[model samples]
Target: MPALKINVHFGGGAELLFDKIKKREVELPAVDKYLPECEKKGWTIRELLVWIKENLLRERPELFLQGESVRPGILVLINDTDWELYGELDYELQPSDTITFISTLHGG
Candidate 1:
């Protein structure tokens, strides 16, 4: 059995969800095919967004906006690289892949 370890950075603490995969499974919804798998796994758009928001908020409260969604600012990095640059959420995952999500910071 293959297992995936996820460290969720949310609200004010880190949460972890470990899953055991026996067959084909998609962890993150990306590209086009991920939706079906994600839906099958109970991850809807709202849920996904909330998950990202909560997790990200935990790490950095300032990063999270009360009403605005976590798009264009929040960064999803996989293995120390931005997933959008590679393929966005559509990036595929293997057994030992580690995904990280964070908010971007800038200065003048």
Candidate 2:
């Protein structure tokens, strides 16, 4: 199985939850390795979230996720475009794609 190379980014305080690294270049393994139950043939944003929580997230998972998706205040962009325009979690990932997460919530 070939790996998919993609860039992941965090900003607007979201990077704090990810060890303040801000950006990462990742290679996703075969679908069966991370998302065995997936019915789809390719990797999707839905599966990527799970992978992140397991492999990349360092702390405060709640601040980044809600149920199987991102918390409401977080903005997700795929290759510089809003993820909503591409089907949100169902968006299939492509090689070299850039996925960015920006937190909209703030403290007083």
Candidate 3:
């Protein structure tokens, strides 16, 4: 299987949780890309969130995750579109796609 390369970005205080790194280009393993549990669902943002927690998050993960998704007040964008428009967590990932996480929870 070929590797799936994609870009991930964090902003709006989300970077604080990722060691202040805002952009990352990662190549996710193609084999069993979505079967971390049991069912065969292609890689989605939901799974990607878990993957990020395990692989990318550097600190204060609780600030980024709530349950299986991003905490409330955070916005997620996939391929320049709102994730909610594309089924939110169920949106299957594609090669070279760009995923962005921006936290709306902030203080002045």
Candidate 4:
């Protein structure tokens, strides 16, 4: 199975949850390998979030995740376009695509 390579970015305080790392290039295994229960052939943002939580997130999972999606106030962009434009969590991921997460919430 071929791996899919994609870029991941965190910003607007979202990076804090990722150990202050602003960017990462991740190589995901075959969709069936990581998401055996999924009926789809391609990887979706929903599955990607699970992978992120397991592989990249170091702490405070609640701050970044809510169920299978991101918490409120977190803006998700795929390939520079809003994820909502691509069906949000159901959007299929493509190789070399860039996925970015920016938090709009801030402490006073």
TM-score for all models, in order of appearance: 0.39, 0.95, 0.89, 0.96
Error of 2 at 50 (Å): 0.2
Write the residue-wise lDDT of candidate 4 on 4-96 in tens digits.
999999999999988999999999999888888877888889989999999999889999999889999999999999998999988989989
Model 2: CA > 4 A from native: none
Pairs with steric clashes in candidate 3:
none
**Which 10-residue span in candidate 1 carries the lowest summed lDDT?**
11-20
| Whole-model lDDT, model 3 | 0.84
lDDT tens digits, residues 1-108, model 1? 123334333211122111212122234434134333343433333344554554333444344443534445556555667666756544545444555545454445
The stretch of ten residues in a row with the least summed lDDT in candidate 4 is 33-42
Q: What residue runs in model 1 are displaced by over 4 Å at the alpha carbon?
A: 1-3, 7-70, 105-108
lDDT of 2 by residue, 1-108 (tens): 467899999999999998899999999998876677766777899999999999999999999999999999999999999999999999999999999999999999
Question: lDDT of each structure?
Answer: 0.42, 0.93, 0.84, 0.93
The predicted structure with the larger lDDT, 1 or 4, is 4
* Quality of model 2 by C-alpha lDDT: 0.93
Could you tell me how far off, in angstroms, the CA of residue 41 lies in candidate 3 after the best superposition? 5.6
**Model 3 lDDT per residue over 1-108, tens place:** 456788999998899988899999987776374454536435778778888998899898788899999999889999879988999988888888999999999787
- Alpha carbon lDDT at 72, candidate 1: 54
- Candidate 3: deviation at residue 95, Å? 0.5
Give the clash count for each candidate. 10, 0, 0, 0
As for model 2, its CA RMSD to the true structure in angstroms is 1.0
- Tell me the deviation in Å of residue 50 in model 1: 7.9
Ranking by TM-score: 4, 2, 3, 1
C-alpha RMSD by candidate, in order:
9.2, 1.0, 1.8, 0.9
